[model samples]
Target: MIIRELITHRWGNKELVTSPSFGTVEKVFVKDDMRVLEWEPLFIIRTENGSLEQIAVGVNGVINSVHVKEGDHVIPGMVMAFIKDDLLDSDIS
Candidate 1:
C-alpha cells in the first residue's frame, strides 16, 4: 500500500527558496531554469549592517522561478525563488 503524507509534510516537489535574513539582494548567481546543487551559492545579500552574506540553494533542483533581483530589499522568510527538486521529481514521476 502506498502511504502518503500531508501536503505540508510532502514538500518535496516545488519548494520555495526563502531569504533567511533581512537585507538587500546584492547579486543573483542563477537565472530561471538553472540547475543547482544543494548548498550552492545562489544569492548574495547586503545586510542592514552592511555585511555581505551569501545565500545558498538548500536543495538540488532546477530553479523554476526567481522573484527577487539584485538591489531588491528582502525581509526574513521572503520567497526568493521556486525550485523543483530533482530527487523529489524522481519519486513523483
Candidate 2:
C-alpha cells in the first residue's frame, strides 16, 4: 500500500499513526495519555521542499506513546505514535 494510506491502523483499542511523507518533525502537539479527536492535528512536519504538513491520528483516542520528536527525520510509513483508540474493529474499513 501507498504510505499515506498506511497512516492509520486499527489494532483492537489501539491505533498506529504513521508518517505520510519524508520530512523532519517540526512540532508535537500532544503527549502520552492525552486524548485526541479524529482528524486532530498531532504533529507538524517540515518537508524536504520546505513546506509544512500536518499529521493526525485519524481516529479518536488517547495517545499511548510517541515515537518521534521535533527535529527527527521521518519517512513514509514511519510509526510516529500509538493511540488507544476508541474505534471498534468494524469502525475501520
Candidate 3:
C-alpha cells in the first residue's frame, strides 16, 4: 500500500500546513542517513503552554521527508517527514 500522500486541507484545494506538535518545537532526533524502527522517538515539540510532546515514527520505514528543522514551530496535521516502509517479500530472492 502506498502510504505517502501530500497533506491537504478539508476543502481539498488548500494545502495542509503543520505547526508545532504542541505549541513549540524543542528538538529533532532523526536526521539524514539514520535508520529507525517502528514507533521510535523521532523528535520533541514543546507547546507554548509549557508541555513537552514526543513525536515518534508511526510505522517501520526510513525517514524520507522532514519539513521542519530544530527550533521551527509546527502545528497539528503537518507533514513532518515521509517514511518508506521496507519490503521484506520483495527482498526475498
Candidate with top lDDT is 2
Task: Give the per-residue lDDT digits (tens) of candidate 2, residues 20-64.
Answer: 889899989989999889878888888888888877655887899
> Which segments of model 2 are wrong by more than 4 Å?
1-7, 88-93
Q: 1-93, model 3: which lDDT tens digit per residue?
A: 112223323222222224434455577777654666765777677776777777654455455556778887776666666555554314677
lDDT of 3 at 23: 58
Provide the RMSD of all predictions against the true structure, rounded to 1 decimal. Answer: 9.0, 4.9, 8.3
User: Could you give candidate 1's per-residue lDDT for residues 1-93 as a string of tens digits?
Assistant: 111111111244587877777889988998999998877878888888888888775578898889999999999878888888877768563
lDDT of 3: 0.56
Q: Show pairs that collide, candidate 3.
A: 18-75, 18-78, 19-74, 19-75, 20-74, 20-75, 23-47, 24-46, 65-81, 65-82
lDDT of 2 at 72: 99
